[model samples]
Target chain A: MQADQSALQCNACGGLCYFSPERSALECLSCGECYDLGQPDDYLARDEFAHRPDVAEPEDNITPAQRTHQCQNCGGEVLFTGPALSAHCPYCNGPVVLVSGDAGYRTMALIPFRVDAAFAKRLAQKWAASRVACPAGLADVVAQGDVAGLYAPFWTFDSDEVVQYWANFVKPGGKAIRISSTKGQMKIAFDDMLMPASPHVTPLIRDGILHDFDPRDLKPYRAGYLAGFAAERHHQTVAEGIAANSADKDLLIRNHIKYKIDRTGVHGIRYLTDTSGIHYRRILLPVWILHYSYGGHAYKIAVSGIDGRTFGERPFARRRLALYSAAISACVIALGMAIGAAAAF
Target chain B: MLAETSPLFAAAALFGLSTYFGLIPIHKLIQMHEARHELRQGSASRLRRAGGWVVVALWLLTVMWCAVFIGDWWASGDYQAASERAWQRIGILAKLAASAGGVR
Candidate 1:
């Protein structure tokens, strides 16, 4: 339980992950074994991700990120804040990242955050207090836990890819499975597709962070954003983040292509990967990460301002089932009576 | 339903009164059910296109009904008379209501 007080190395994965969730004993995402968040290192170490987590990662239909441009050389994603032309793709073990978009060449537009560390601290505190349900360390979770505000490393990309897609669709009766494909050549110019430099923050989550931010008011990456914070460095490479965001970009491609084709149903997509090069913009996005303590345990959730989007799980409210069932029964009865009257008439 | 009721506030009111008096308990029961989530098994996406069309139709009809009201006012007796008393009075009322953001 003392390990819950301060940061400790995980015996399983050597990750600096906090023993969070209040309800569950410390379940190492990297190791997949649940332990006392209090005594996480007693168990010997082993790989946990042999199989994917039972819960599937949510799809990008929620919110997606924005990047500045496309990479021309290796078609790997790019996110350069300063004047850098190219970078290496850690994935394919090749140097393929290239800057080849308008935002890449010119130091154009930006809108930095007006909120300072004091404000962000207050915000984080308020956020932490709201999660009084979590057991991280009810009083000390937000009070003592490292709440420094540093500009976390990020790579923002913006690009417009002319995507083409073909999908299979069946009629109402499934009489014939016809292919309704589209070859759309439209420009989807967006500003901030942020991928967190830290491994702790998954590309999936960071991409969502950027997507949630309103593009209409994005300030250029500024140093002041780092004013008073502890920041995480990038452990996951741009290649990995690209792989994460690619799922979404492909979906965008599908939708744009579908718009061109103009149809409804789709059975499966033959994901034609990497059609367009991506432009890059390294940026800092504001997030209020809160640590909470419930019953002798800790939990955290990131509150995004880009939109009021939250990512974390608190157990379902106990009374929810009863309330839901009552509501459903009442509605069903009313609907039935109305239908019966209509039938009689 | 504006297109259907713009000219007959009286009829719309009558219907509204009838529904209220006749289905009061039924409606309450429906509300109760909705609060407790008695909805049939369907995701939001499933409900969207089906419900969206109903909303679209309702909006269109309402707008059309308002257009009828304007047409009737324009063709009234005062507008066609040598002394424009009735038409002018209505025009003044329309102007005042417009200024108040009530008519428009």
Candidate 2:
């Protein structure tokens, strides 16, 4: 348990150290002194699915809260609930890291937070201001709230797929309908099909948050990288992630076959695909979530920490929309009158 | 008089409808792609931005040419000649399509 603690005790002032996103190092909270955590190791990926953890049963979606670890700095027992990888020691305010027993199942990878809290808040404010229906004060409300940086878990699957498809093609002629049948096979290799490893984050939200994230940004996971921010351990295993993403993969393969062989008007398309050479890597992606209330209704905004891309819900003013409608209508009417005058002349 | 030129009006209406329904969305897509480039440094952002701008520029150029043709027709007070010219262009297009076996 002591080995999991990534905090460095300040020699000059005995304060709990936090990972500074700005400097990419550990800094003492009391003295403002920094300590370099050294270089990150190479990320690892495994191709075998059989080597997955035994606890990866279909129903085993919860990380046990009973996993207790003692904080080295304060000697306080820190209880990890759900899939939380790191948390502050309640007694002495020291950071405690919990190593989920499934660490050996897959070599962990993580993209450390590049955008700091202040920048994330600024991004949220800018996004709020750009919203067409946003109330005037919503930007200020979002900017005032603290942005919580989280390292969300994801499973990236690599696979070699073979698809066999058959379809009937039809065309309408001047006097008769023509029908033809065709069959074909396709081979495709997919490098990464990303899937969310936590049930808390939906697939749609995950795609929005990690839209264009490059896997090259990821480094081998170390508790040092997760010192300050919250990290969620992977509760859904490799099998579960694959099951969740298989339908989309199948659709992708079918589309590839369609593009390669058939024209746009193909009908009654059917296919069966076989996937092999399947590999998966478990990774943590950084996101900053901001929550604010407008007219008593709460909304959440998530910004990608790797890049400043923001996504969220914002309240819209009905009056503004009505005004926009009126303006567009007036322009259209004026344009019509001008075009009519031209035709008449 | 409007009923006599209903076909011309229909073509203009179609153009306006397609511009609002189709071209507007494509323009919004260009804006979105450029915005993503500014924010995310994505691998495909640059390519998408360039391609989107080319498409928008081509659409705008076509619209400009149409506006110029209409201005010249109105200036000369030769609306019948302008309509005949449009039909002649469409007839040439039909002949090309028939030669290419696209029109049966």
Candidate 3:
């Protein structure tokens, strides 16, 4: 595949432009002009079904770091140099998407950043301040931290599932409990089950900040939306994503079966699941990451760019916790002594 | 009366209460640290696990010590005294209730 490149430049001043979340358009850095990208194409064309055979398999020998693209505006060649698929040209400062030899998979859709960087930092500070066990000045330290906005890769899967199960339950009779076996089949349709496609975002951070993203807001993939922001392609394959999605589906199926049975005495559950009509789309999700250090230990906090929700690690205040424990102990002892004196009287 | 008045009983109660209150926050802190470590390293550190177990062992020892003391007090016939003291408190509460009823 050849490299697909587009240079986002301001028409008025011919300066570099970036996507501004507040304006929902490309904003030039030099003259502060906003260019409206016209309506996005329909997102349906990006969905690739597993049963389809016409789609070409990803190339095995294309190295991401070695790939390079020529800037359309300056004719300057820019090396990817990293796992990132989108970056600004150093020479001309034009935003570019280097799509050549990107393992055959392309980002089909993206959820643009709704919460800006300043708001994201405030969210992180509020989250840190709310932790009761955190150090006294942790929020102040977090306020000074720099937050970087990046579009992370993710996969959304849709499938139809048929689950068959057998279970035993106890039926209470007039005088005794009788055990009986039951068997049944259930059909479930799962839509847009999201899975992270980048290893840079750890599972803990992913699970912590992930919330329901509105499918209606998914705009068709456009390079202008990624202007002035860092973006990465999927390092994980569709097959690997499917395997992870299967584990999640199995847990969901078990919960559904348990809910359907509605018996606490049920035991020895056995089940089989058959899945079909599997469809997937590679998409980009926005996130803001803030890295900071406290007491010589470094920590990072992630904020969802769509909703500004924050989650991360912070250091505990040992002296304050010891004081709280001492106070509680004293109160417990005093209450006990008072009760004893009243009883003696 | 003897159980309530015994210094050993008071000491045991204080020790149990202090240990319970003191170790709970530390245990929670260690657990949070372990979770962060696992998030970074993909597995829990042995030292953190040992710290958690040490907290558990301390709590268990406190519970066992309190249990043994109570068992000894019961075997020494202090329960009878304790029961009498409880009844005395109940009598006082009943008298107070009767006086309040009369005033009403």
Best by TM-score: 3
What would the per-residue lDDT of candidate 1 be over residues A1-345, giving only the tens digit for each residue?
123212334467754332222322333445654444322432221111111223354322221112222334333343422112223322111344333332222112222333443444455555444542233433344555332222344556555454434455433324233344433344555344444544445443443233435444544322222222222223333455566566445555554544444444543545343333455443445454544444455454444433334443232222333344344334433443343233222
Residue lDDT tens for model 2, A206-272: 6556777677777776666766676556655567677776655655565566566545245567888
lDDT of 1: 0.36
Would candidate 3 be rated incorrect, acceptable, medium or high by CAPRI criteria?
Answer: incorrect
Better of 1 and 2 by DockQ: 2
Shares of reference contacts reproduced by the candidates, in order, are 0.00, 0.00, 0.06
Top lDDT prediction, candidate number:
3
Model 3 spans > 4 angstroms off: A1-6, A40-104, A166-185, A261-270, A319-345, B1-104
Instruction: Please give, for residues A1-345, the per-residue lDDT of candidate 3 as tens digits.
Output: 122233566778877677888898888888999987657555553555463224567533333432545456554443342223444443333455554544435567888888888899999998888776578989999998767677777787788889899987666434344567888999888777666775455554555565556666787777677765665656556677776555545656766676677764566778998877778777888888786788988677888888786777778787766666655555544454445544443
Score candidate 3 by TM-score against the native: 0.64
TM-score of chain B of each: 0.28, 0.45, 0.38
**Candidates arranged by DockQ, highest first:** 3, 2, 1
How do the candidates rank by lDDT, highest first?
A: 3, 2, 1
Residue-wise lDDT of candidate 2 within B1-104, one digit each (tens)? 53255444544653564355443435444355535544333222222333344344334334433443444354445667655554544444433323332110
